[model samples]
Target: MTETTPYDADRARFTRQAPARLVLCDHAVDVADGAAGLVATEHDPDARPGGRVSQAVQLLELTERALVSAVIYERERGSSWAEITQYLGIGPAEAEKRFAAKLAGWDTAFDVPYRLDDTGRKRIPQLPTAAYDPAWACTQLDRWAGNRLILVDNEHPVSSGLVMAVPKT
Candidate 1:
């Protein structure tokens, strides 16, 4: 037999004067029974940019890397370094040199022919997706949720995944 909940009396007395409501991130919550129409807004006021760096900044860097990596794959798949580098908002020549080296390193390590940089031919390497499409990841941040950190999708790796605050219930 299952034990009875002691709040049986309150269960019968439960009656909400208004529809259930929720306040999302950075929003104010109206207290259902606070004195005189009480409303309160909460925030993560004290930010500890601790550990020598904040997670917010770290996440941004990771996203940028993921974007670069995805662009590299796109280049290997036929996109041009000129186009990709321009899209990445980097100085064409400088970014080209930097990215070419990165892709070549990946190719040598993986023994794949995706990168042709050593041949003086600029091309993309079929790296194992060292990063993900940054734009796709950024879309998920269109909304502000709670301060709690949570992964948006588990199956997708962090390079391809997203992180956001928990939704306020």
Candidate 2:
């Protein structure tokens, strides 16, 4: 038998409220503030070198990087790998390899389709997903409604993912 975790319970609760619209949003401000707080706490002489603050800072950095990747993917939705690589300052293979997972998550979060019509021709739309919008993200955060659920890792002060929750309203 598998042991049940709190996360699993939360997910179950979230799923039971399914058929509800889920919205994903970026955690830009939360990540920034958390990073700043970590830096501040770390600056204290009494604080240990590898304490919660240090760990939080690392997580915040990762979240920031993920957010950056999401932004780039949104900005260059239809661009080729070569183009994305150039913009990201990484080689084609590296770019794809590094961002593939994150991009997949983003794609799912945004409910982006495989193709869109452009000029009467099928083409990929750049940032077709509204989840990347900072304003939308903020609104969701404020409302706390819908399938959008913010995942806040205890280790980090800010959220990691803006998961959609079942809309109560």
Model number with the top TM-score: 2
Q: Against the true structure, what is each candidate's TM-score? A: 0.36, 0.40
lDDT of 1 by residue, 74-145 (tens): 554466777777676776678778777766764463344244467755645342321112232223322222
- Candidate lDDT (C-alpha), each: 0.37, 0.45
On the 0 to 100 scale, the lDDT of residue 71 in model 2 is 42
The TM-score measured for candidate 1 stands at 0.36
Candidate 1 structure lDDT: 0.37
Which parts of model 1 are misplaced by more than 4 Å?
1-53, 112-169
